[model samples]
Target: MLPIRECVEQTSGYIPGEQPRTNDFIKLNTNENPYPPPLEIFEGLQQELTKVRLYPDPVSTQLRKAAAKVFGVSSVNILAGNGSDDILNIAVRTFVNPGETVTFLDLTYSLYETIARVHGASVIKIPTDNRFAINQPIICPKAKLIFIASPNPPVGKHLNRDYLEETCERATGIVLIDEAYADFSDENHLDFLNKYDNVIISRTMSKSYSIAGMRVGFGIASIPIIEQMNKVKDSYNLDRIAQLLGTNAFNFQEYFKVIWQKVRQTRSHLIESLKALDFLVFDSDSNFVFASSQWIPASELYKKLKERKILVRYFENPRIKDYVRISVGTDQEIARLLEVINEIKSGQEFT
Candidate 1:
């Protein structure tokens, strides 16, 4: 057998949401923006296509400047990455030494566990109550890195700011708040950066800017933390086209705000519809909702939806086995989903 690190060999890597081969289905599985990005992004990309032959700006300088201007921070306070996933990986590599501990909410982005394990770091899961609220103190005295997702996935429940601030004050580690879905949420933790030197707020353009295909993201932190993470990241992490498009995306924030509002509106409708079907839906601050059903096994519901060519996320983990995560789609897409769900509810086969 080919040689591999023992930790890598033992790990079961992260499984992303499914992507169908055909466009025939209405997709609500991955939490991607259903709307197209502003025309400026494409227009900028067309001009930058010629530069693909050259190496990208290694530090993504212009992109950072654009983001800094919009976020009211200096470029030195931001670090650009291929995606927020890269930023997370960089943090894990730079801060957490091998065999050191990393911690996060139990049901958060599973990638946190996978990343730590792959890097040979021990993981501590902070337990949450039935409502997905942290029941234990999030401060892990021994942990060197802590990842917390606001408007966290699977449940889309935002963590309490008081608890988060307390964790920042008390923990001995770097607290990285994964705000990938913050654009859809009620509040963000960027302000935490000013108050806490240990805090890092990572953002992605995938969901709000409708640029998942471009893989653009940023890590906002104290200048020192940003500098260290930059060292660990891949040289030229953001490609030429990605940098051009990502920088252009910041120029159209007003247009993007319109898209965010639309997603929120559709999310309200999706929640109400799920409730009508007897699903216990969580109050979501993200672009997706976590819903549990007493009438049918989530596995059965997932299978039936796939049979009808409507895709959503269903985790087999025992804690969330009764639930499915549905992404907020376009109004027309959501209407079709609700109609199909009604049909599935009446069929009685899943029950």
Candidate 2:
């Protein structure tokens, strides 16, 4: 038998959303931006090809500076990573001991539990209310780390701000807000950083900036927290290409703002369309909607959509088994999805 760490051997790793092999499908499974990145970001890449032979900037100074400028924080407060997953791994490693508790909301980002389990830390999943909101304080006295995904996945419900602030006040550990979807939300917990020393907000360029291919993410926290996380990070966490693209991506926020607006508009349309089809759709603050239909099983709906080459996410977990999470695509793509859904509702079967 192969020798592996007990934690790894015992764990069933996270199952990510589907990525179809062909480009012939309308993909709404993974919550990726449907739009292409700004053309300006690619203009200087050819000139940067020579620098790839050398090691990237160890500290990612310029990238951090650019991100800091956009986020309205000093460079000292920012720590860049290969992606927010890298940041989450680093945070779990830096703050938690082998058996220390790491807790997060149930049905949030599944990756949180996976990361903690892989690191040999104890994990606790707190149950949310029926609407996917947690009404009580999220406090674990024995915990060393707490991960909260704002506008959480599977269902794009935002965590209650009051409960979160109360959690920060009462908990004796680090509270890391995984804000990958914050760009699509109306509010965020950035203000918590000023009020609390143990708060960390992790952001990614994948969702809003349309740079998932670049694998760029940032950790925004106090200088002390940033310094510790930096120790656990790879020597060159952000490669030259990522740093260059990420820096340029931050500079083009005005251009992306228009795209964000478009996404919000599409998201509204998606919710209404799903409701019109009698799907029980949640009010989404993120760029996707969580919906379920009484007329059909979500798994069956998923298969039907896939048969037509239109994909969306369906979780097997019993609590949300009836629901499918659909990423907001461009107007035409969403229209096509609605059309197919209507056909399915009318009992039309596709071969």
Quantify all predictions' global Cα lDDT against the true fold.
0.90, 0.90
**Model 2 Cα displacement at 181 (Å)?**
0.8
Q: Taking the tens digit of each residue's C-alpha lDDT, what string does model 1 give over 1-351?
A: 222388888888999999999999889999999999877677766667877888989998999999999878999999999899999999999999888999988789999999998999988998888887885459789999999999886688788889899999998989999999988866988889889999999999999989899999999999899989988999889999888889989999889999998899999999988999899999999999999877788999999999999999999899999899999999999999999888978888555
Worst window of 10 by summed lDDT in candidate 1: 1-10
lDDT of 2 by residue, 305-347 (tens): 9999999999998889999999999999999999999999898
Residue 147's C-alpha lDDT in candidate 1?
Answer: 95
Model 1 error, position 285 (Å): 0.2
- Give TM-scores for every candidate, taking all chains together and pairing residue i with residue i: 0.97, 0.97
User: Any idea what lDDT model 2 has?
Assistant: 0.90
Which residue segments of model 1 deviate by more than 4 Å?
1-4, 349-351
Q: List the residue pairs that clash in candidate 1.
A: none
RMSD of 1: 2.1
Against the true structure, candidate 2 reaches a TM-score of: 0.97
